[model samples]
Target: MTSPTIVTAAMLAIGDELLSGRTKDKNIGHLADMLTMVGIDLREVRIVADDQDAIVEALNALRSRYRHVFTSGGIGPTHDDITADAISKAFGVECIHEPKAMELLAAMYERRGMEFTEARKRMARMPEGATHIPNPVSTAPGFAIENVYVMAGVPQVFQAMLDALLPSLETGTPVLSRTVRSPYGEGDIGAPLTEVQKNHPETSIGSYPRFDGKSFSTDIVIRARDATVLGAAETEVIAMIEAIGRSREKHQP
Candidate 1:
């Protein structure tokens, strides 16, 4: 049988606020969930400060390793917002004020009766030859160069930028999952779970233990791109749970 196509991506969250714990990161989880729905598996996530060298190094590493690389933060109008410069260095291009972005930002500010200052114009800067990622929340647009998508750091703006960016990307087969709950602990099912995993090489099996104040239970998650394979593996997991349940009953007073 032919294997399903797998498209992978990596995420880079940039800012000293995230590392300092002043700003809680909401982009990584949102990006992961959104990418999974569109069949792009998010393989890695890295958070870096507003240093140019670190940003450039991380961008090069991730872009080389994955089919797509997404970045958030440090593209604002301040001195530390140097993501555009880092991207330009990474791709060997000039970071210039993109005409289209400049037009959009200028128009938005004019309509709002605000001054289009030099600091605001910095929002229009991007690596030359890059495409724009629209931000409906704020008029300052994000930019996409080659396989790297540079987006806003603010959670609302980042999600809006992603909604605009996803349609342009190539997607793979979506992964499906099933969860089975067991009253037993991981200890009771470790060996059997290993056997079930070995029995179905096409599926991924994971056991997570949960505590409910009084005792522990397990949640087994089975994941696969093929529905048939997923169902077969799920059936095996249910049978294993039943067998363990029966054994516990037999030994109980």
Candidate 2:
């Protein structure tokens, strides 16, 4: 048997702006796609305000449920930046001044002719025992502790940090996916769709309903690592969809 390995992750977006609909969170989608390419499963994503209680609760829950938890936002120079402290409280550790983070921030500020004020110094603070996640786009760095990977609020900076960090992460066998679309409603093929998944426990069969105003159809997708398994699953799916085609329902599936 193939060695068992699967890396699961949860994404946490922290900020009042995202919840208020003032800012659209684009990091989750980017993160999901990036993680998928690297064989890491994006198990779940949580969005919360810049509240200490909320951050603590979310971090604790995700850590318990998923193998990896990624938090974005609340790591800025502003007064509302409090992610580090909340994380510290959750892990029962002290939020202390991180020397490596300080050095990076100091050198970055010096180059940009910016003052490293008390507010700016907050960027250097992280949970004790957490390692820094380098931010190539901006000076403020992200940090990782155990399975939790804390990142920046800014989308651009967060993506840069992810690029630098994801490559080194241990991953599972890359999941392969294939989608087949037909002019058939999900109800027409739901029964056979269920059987295919039951028959092939290793493959997951998904049916997505779509209405293009002119017609309705279901996009059947099969996901699995073994190529042979995926092919067998797809064949069963197409045959089932074809069997459900009615004279009036496009006569196609």
User: Which candidate wins on TM-score?
Assistant: 1
> Which residue pairs come into collision in candidate 1?
none
List, residue by residue over 180-249, the lDDT tens digit for candidate 1: 9988999999999999999999999999999999888999999999999999999999999999989988
Q: How large is the C-alpha RMSD of every model relative to the true structure?
A: 1.1, 2.5
lDDT tens readout by residue for model 2, 72-172: 99998788999999999999999988998888889888998989898989999999999989888876889999999999978899999999898778788
lDDT of 2 at 199: 96
Candidate 2 ranges beyond 4 A from true positions: 1-4, 244-253
Give the clash count for each candidate.
0, 0
User: TM-score of predicted model 2?
Assistant: 0.91
Best by lDDT: 1
TM-score of every model versus the real structure = 0.97, 0.91
